[model samples]
Target: MKLEALAVYEQPLKWFALGLGVCSTVCVVQGWQLAAMLFSLPFCLIWMYSGWLRTEPQLKYINMLFSVLYVYGIGRYFWLQA
Candidate 1:
C-alpha cells in the first residue's frame, strides 16, 4: 500500500480500536455480555489491521487471539441462552 493510504488506514484503525475497546469494556460492566462480544469483534479486527500496517508481530498475534476469544464469547453467549 502507498504511504498515504497506509497512513490513512492507520489513523482510523487506531481510533476505532481504542473506541471499540472502551465500548466493549462498558458493555461488560453494564452486564451486556452479548453486546460486549459483538463490540469486540470489530475491535479485534481493527487492532489486527493496525498491527499489519505497522508490521508488529506481537500486536498481530495478540489481536488474533482476542478475535478468537471474541468469537468464542459470541458463540457461548448464544449457546447458553438457548
Candidate 2:
C-alpha cells in the first residue's frame, strides 16, 4: 500500500488501539484476567505494527514485548483452565 493510504489509517488505528487498551484496563479492574489479556494482545499488536510503520524502535520493541507477554498470559490462562 502507498504511504498515503497508511497515513490515512494511522490515526484511526491509534484510536482503536487506545480503545482496546482502555477495555483491557477495565477488564483487569473487573478481575477478568482472560478478557484483559485478550484485549491487551491486540492493543499491543496494533501499536507494534504502528511503530514498525513509523520506524519507531522504542515503540515497536516495547509493544512487541507486551504482545509476547500478553500471548503468554493468554496461553497460561487457558492452560490453567484445562
Candidate 3:
C-alpha cells in the first residue's frame, strides 16, 4: 500500500483509537479489568503507531510501555485460565 493510502486513513484511525480509549476507560470504571485491557491494548497500539509515524518520542514511548503492559495483562489472563 502507498503511504498516501495510509495518510488518508490516519484521521479515521485516530478517531477509532480515541473511541477505543473511551471504551477502555468505561471498562475500567465498571471494574472490568480484562475488558479494559482488551480495549486498551488496541488503543495503545494505535497511538503508538501514530506516534511513530509523527515522530513524537514521548507519545510513542508512553504508548509503547502501555502496549507492553496490556499485552502482558492479556497474556497473564489467559495463562491463568489454562
On lDDT, the candidate that comes out on top is 3
Candidate 1 per-residue lDDT over residues 1-82, each given as its tens digit:
5644766767767787788889989998999988988988998888787787778899899989989998998888889989
Flag regions of model 1 displaced more than 4 Å. Answer: 1-7
Per-candidate Cα RMSD to the true structure, in Å, reads: 2.5, 1.8, 1.6
Ten contiguous residues minimizing lDDT sum, candidate 1: 1-10
- What TM-score would candidate 1 get against the native? 0.81
- lDDT by residue (1-82, candidate 2, tens digit) is 7544677788888899899989989998999999999998988888887887789999999998988898888899889989
- For each candidate, the alpha-carbon lDDT, in order, equals 0.85, 0.88, 0.88
Consecutive 10-residue window with the lowest summed lDDT within model 3: 1-10
lDDT score of model 3? 0.88
CA lDDT, candidate 3, residue 80 = 98
Residue 31 miss distance in model 3 (angstroms): 0.8
Q: Scored by Cα lDDT, where does model 2 land? A: 0.88
**In model 3, which runs have C-alpha deviations exceeding 4 angstroms?**
1-5
